[model samples]
Target: MSEKATLKRSLGLWAIVALGLGYMTPTVVFDTFGIVAKQTNGVVPLAYIVALVVMLFTAISYGKMVRVFPSAGSAYTYTRETMGANAGFLVGWASLLDYLLLPLVNALIIRLYMESLFPEIPAWIWVVLYVAVVTFINVWSMGSTSGLNSLLVIFTVLLVVTFIVLASVQLYQGMGAGTLFTLNPIAHENVQAVAVLTGATIVCFSFIGFDAITMYTEEAANPNTVPRAIFLTVLIGGGIFFIAAYYTQALFPDLGVFHLLDDTLPEIGLYVGGKAFQLIFLAGAFAATVASGLASHASVSRLLYVMGRNGVLPRKAFGYVHPKFRTPAFNVIFVGAVSLLAIGPSLELISAVINFGALIAFTFVNLSVIAYFAFQQKRYKRPVDIFSYIIMPSIGAGFTGVLWYFLHADAFIGGIVWVSIGISYMLFLTKFFRTKMVDLDFDEADRPIGKEA
Candidate 1:
């Protein structure tokens, strides 16, 4: 199949924004922050603020790089341009885990929720059904998937807003000096700062998907709109959602009242409003999981397609595009199949594996940004400030690295095992499945007519 025939630019700015927000849905953010809030009382918002600052520096670096090299490979392409093909391949290999694990995590969550509703249905059956439906959506066409995602995004935002509004009403009814505005909840002397930060690092996982917007740049209606969408998605989708969710948790003083660690939905619903709120929150949670599943499936397929195109994988099958749909049919099916198999048995394991891979990938992307900026200092003629070049990345990396250390030993072991698998696969590909590297100049990839390249 020819590259031009397979490539389609169909997603607009709003769609891209929805895509990012849909992937970073409130369920994920709330669940993550709830865990941290339980540990540090109401200080979850502080953790989010710190995470946002850290992510912003990386986002700035990504925004600059996206303007220059707007490709489907995103991080892989960026690393290859600055570093070498080998380093890029390693990053790509590691990232494969991020995309692949996301769908599995979603599928597992969906199964758990489905079982709550239909106790008779086997969890594995629900997993299979969820994967099948999401896979069908992903393979049908990019436009169809994006349209569904847009709808899901709207529903998700409304649900979250409803919860927030209800929570605010409850807080107001409680009258003067409610827990909503009190610092006392988070000012406990026993609360360790490092523990709060560590839990917050885990919470940062929900915000991770906004950067996945870069992966779709090749198909974005206007490539320039991507960075803006990403920024807005992070600010509004991740930032505001986190603030509302954490603030609501703060309004209710007792963390133990919710039983967060044991319950998936957390205590936000019960504390904020009541059963009505809990039901609405449950619906939103389901939608968020499904939306995230769909987004992750789409992204993994695209990453696989890019890898196949670059001859890092078996190009003959994975690189093939549907003659009519112009979509990566095999790649989508493959991701779905793998997700179903991987997540059907163990939800807890799936969550741990997914979060572990995600944090590692996040750490790498931030480090890549620092390296990219440092290398381009002379070419861009930008000020080579020590803070930008060294301090910021060091801080981000150190925090993330510490979080990686704090991950459960089982998760650490699982992540290490996955990384080893990726390395082995890369070695095998280099030895047997390799193809000549394509010579596409990223410098000219997004340039317009008569524009400097």
Candidate 2:
């Protein structure tokens, strides 16, 4: 039977932006800096700025590429078109881990927060229930998920902004003994470049899902609106996260609050304002985590749908779309089920596996941007210049490489195991499945004359 026509482009620019930010905001404000502080000793905001700069170049490349190839596959499409089918498939396989692990991490986090309130319910039950609900939301209709995501995003943004403003006011009023700004809190007196780069990696992980918007290109009202939304989402999301980290450091100069990383609810309320602030922060954190899970389910389902359409999987089952709802019905449920099963093992272990996949995907994305620009210049004589094509990617890869080095040994081992699984799967597809591969047209669009090469 023929597949249904591709999803209609119904999502507006603002909703698309909210969808991406909603996925990103929850963890960055509350969880990300805590990791950076552990590595850099409270200079987490500095690490955030550093990671933002590295990510900016990649974001620029992604912005340019998305306009030319407005498909649901994202980097999977770009790498395939410019490089080859094998390269694209590899990226797609790696990204599968990234998207799959995000929902698991989000659900686990939400489970932790919910346990604080409910206390009686088992964490595993909450994890299963959270994934089930999010999967249902994803399978119902894209329009419905987009609407809910928009509403949650508004609440997330407001809570984050309020926390920032309140923290800033308290610092200005000298309400606490913490320093307004000081490098003194950093653990090492003689900070090495490696340490900074390592800290930036952990910080950048928090910013991972900001690009999930690209997965919705096929469903966006205007494809051109995506590039602007991507840049804006990264800027606004990264900026808010950076500011939040700075204020957090200023309020609690010692960074002791972050020691609660292993703690369930992470007493951010006390550090930010007090009891009232804590409750508000907890509510916002929960909303953000749930939103992230919803967004993750949405994006991963699309990826699987697209991959199935391309004949890389059991197309009959994986490619199935909802007859009435017109969504990726099977893929949505598949991801949610996998994520739910994952939460039972160990939260920290799950987090490590997800981070490993994310870092690898990030590394490839940065490299793909460089490779794409280089291919463009070589094939079409397009003048992208050395700075964008060479310098930026080199710096991004360098920084990210260092960050990967500092990851826990267990995370590294888990990442290796995951990739090995992907490699084995790809080998089976080529041998037994013998899937036909298609060549992509990356040079369809022309560069403006006299542009820098």
Candidate 3:
């Protein structure tokens, strides 16, 4: 194959971080702030604090695994390489759930926001338009995708800063909680563990964008840059959420007055900054979702391309990148088609399932770290080694497992059904363990364009 046929390595560290934040959609704090506040009884920031700490452990484990594998397919590749083909196959299939639903979920939310703004148009129109636009940009160019992500992330940051300033001003003028500094948003007279845990689960979704950056494993300029970018992405994105939640809750501490959990932030925007700011906030949110939806769409396509090329899936379609654009053409369109499902379900129900596959995938990533560093490499001699390899990953796995345990029964059963289908397919493909491995070349998967030397 010619050099032009391979994936390009134009993404630098900052570009990767920007891509992760773009996938994360920092403005999401505004969208979910009221819900978290209600769930936590006004201690939204504490939930984010817990979520941030939990994510750091997983981020550390992910950094370790990506350093070991240093290829595409994210958790799928890590678990497969460390555990076995069977484990890898199932994890990859599990990830398929996250990757497939994310774009659809984003589109659904985007459609809702649009419906709120312009009620006359049918919601399907918004979903179709967003799916088409984002799909076209992704298929057209990787540079364009990252570039758009950078712009959107920057705009979101600016909008967040503006909201903070406006909310702070309002608080100083004796509005809402009438104070900027208060333990009320982090902890109160009667903070409950169950409430915090529920909020933590919702906030966990906010941090998964860093993990999604692993989809660009083969495309990063330096593979080592990936781990650093992942850590920074989580911290930076979490910081935004922390700050946003703190002020938003401080501005509107009363959850009973929120009336509409789905559109609470917009109501706050109107209360604190008036109708103009409310519209601007809505625009910022819509933009944030687009950035998120676009990055997620790109990630899932790469996943299918890698698995398809490896014979874990159909080779002719998902495996085939466009000759001119060098993008996963078929997988791109397929994910867009699946986004149509967003139109049927209640957005909240679909959103519940998002965390299921993601949390499971994360728990295994922690185990992958233990499998690689402690068992495979036998590097548990030193205190640092034992801590990083065994202790941290163990904590991460246990924490993520707890979150998975608490997921809605619908998501729990749905996840089981999804995994069973993967297991069944694997059994059929491998003939009950007769074929041990798929012919996947992680090196060939990441083989850069300028490797003549």
Return the candidate ranking by lDDT, descending: 3, 2, 1
**Which scores greater on lDDT, model 1 or model 3?**
3
What TM-score against the true fold does each predicted structure earn? 0.81, 0.83, 0.90
Candidate 3 deviation (Cα RMSD) = 3.0
Write the number of the candidate with greater lDDT, choosing between 1 and 2: 2
Write down the RMSD of candidate 2 (Cα, Å): 6.4
Candidate scoring better on TM-score of 1 and 3: 3
- Cα deviation at 221, candidate 1, in Å, is 5.6
Candidate 1: worst 10 consecutive residues by lDDT? Answer: 442-451
Give residue 353's error in model 3 in angstroms: 1.0
Deviation (Å) of 429 in candidate 2: 2.0
RMSD of each: 5.2, 6.4, 3.0
What digit string (tens of lDDT, one per residue) describes model 3 on residues 186-263? 877879988788778877877767887776778898888999989999999999999998898888778776655864
lDDT of each residue in 85-192, candidate 2, tens digit only? 777776667667877787777877776676655778777888878888888888886544688878888887788788778877787778444446655434346556
Deviation (Å) of 87 in candidate 1 = 1.2
List the global CA lDDT of all models.
Answer: 0.66, 0.68, 0.80
Clashes of each: 0, 3, 0
Candidate 1: TM-score? 0.81
The superposed Cα distance between candidate 1 and the true structure at residue 395, in angstroms, equals 4.4
